[model samples]
Target: MPLTFEDLLARARALPRLGHRALLGIAGSPGAGKSTLAEQLVRTLNGEGEPWVAHVPMDGFHLADVELDRLGRRDRKGAPDTFDAAGYAALLRRLREERDEGGEVVYAPGFERVLEQPLAGAIAVPPTARLVVTEGNYLLLDTGAWSRVRAQLDEVWFCAPDEDERVRRLVARHEEFGKSHQEAVAWVLRSDERNARLVAATRERADLVVRDLVGWPDRHGRPRTGGEPGPVGTDTGC
Candidate 1:
């Protein structure tokens, strides 16, 4: 009765409908491994060939610092209201439409952790891409425009790991991103935890609750020097 990693992969591999694009959303609390799983799914599915699966993370929608400062919500950067939810939904819709119409390449934005800014058109969804894999902390959120995100997605899976492990990963991630241990620990408790609780509240709204983490080893076994989180399907970068 469990959805193994392989099962998830199989389901993702089969998501595209006849001549239409498929949008798969991964939702989870902070450090729940959503990004990791999405990346792994796309990577494994694409194998060594051309990429048919494209990764479009919701982090790109995070409000720029200037905007957040203007809104006076900079302290709560990861909160639901801190992102351009409506814009994100619009992109999802466009990605699907472009894929379905077999039109020009679809360009998506990317988030830069070091600068804590969103780079426009940083990610490209090729015309050949049939599946769009997206992950974020608020995919299942029902607030404001967030509710519309679910409509654009074919399926949304919730990633949930042990709370303690999630916290550990979150702290480590912050440290890897240049925050001192104390600062990382403090930020995790003060900020990330709040976001995590909000995200956890939406778990029931997801199509699947993924609890297992593939591994906890130094993800990608790479030295933890980068602030950006990548396919940690193998870090909380999820």
Candidate 2:
């Protein structure tokens, strides 16, 4: 049977039960809905209650544009090397330590979409949070500091939507972020596609492969997969 959103919710809800706090990693190619699914899980789990689920996206660890320029890798801005992977790993370790010791609040950096920069001390994860949902493109990569990242995650899920739909969403996302249609298409093909291929290669490492997360119910409550289309917002180009 195809996995429903409820099944994903149940799986994510069970993570915190394993220990004091659990880290859930969502990894996927560009425009595969990793951020969207993570956001929904955190929102639905917390409900209208005290907010036990906190979202800590890996986008915050993205290297600043200036740093990328200095490193002469600005053209491959979203590639794995364009991020502070080690710093992100340290942050995850800190989150686990704080969860175990019942320590003070931990602040995480956040990415400013319009400015395309990492903002420090932007997200606060309190000790009350029992589950931290972090999503990124390279969480399942088994090389370099990314390997340390996978070790920290309790379970990692990979988003695998239809390839054509994913590409469309990627192009649209670039346009939404202030790029011309032609420019968006060019970037998607030249830069994002390369990163996407790298991300796809790590799919086998995920504990779960979600092939239909972008689907939704119709007016009659029928399940639809990759039939709906629109802007993906923060779901892509992260």
TM-score, one value per model: 0.88, 0.90
Clashing pairs in 1: 35-238, 36-233
Worst window of 10 by summed lDDT in candidate 2? 229-238
lDDT of 2: 0.84
lDDT, model 2, position 216? 51
lDDT, each prediction: 0.81, 0.84
Q: In every candidate, how many clashes are there? A: 2, 0
Full-model lDDT, candidate 1: 0.81
Worst 10 residues of 1 by lDDT: 229-238
Give the winner by lDDT: 2
Residues 1-238, candidate 1, lDDT per residue (tens digit)? 5444567777788889888999999998988777777777777778758778999999999989999999999988898989999999999999878744638988888999888899999998888889999999998889799999998999888877767877888898899889999999988888999888888888888876777454322235343333333322322222
- Per-residue C-alpha lDDT of model 2 across residues 1-238, encoded as one tens digit per residue: 6666777778888888645789999888999887877887787788758789999999999999999999999999999999999999999999877753547899999999889899999999998889999999999888899889988898988888779989998999899999999999999999999999999998878888877444554323455555652112112211
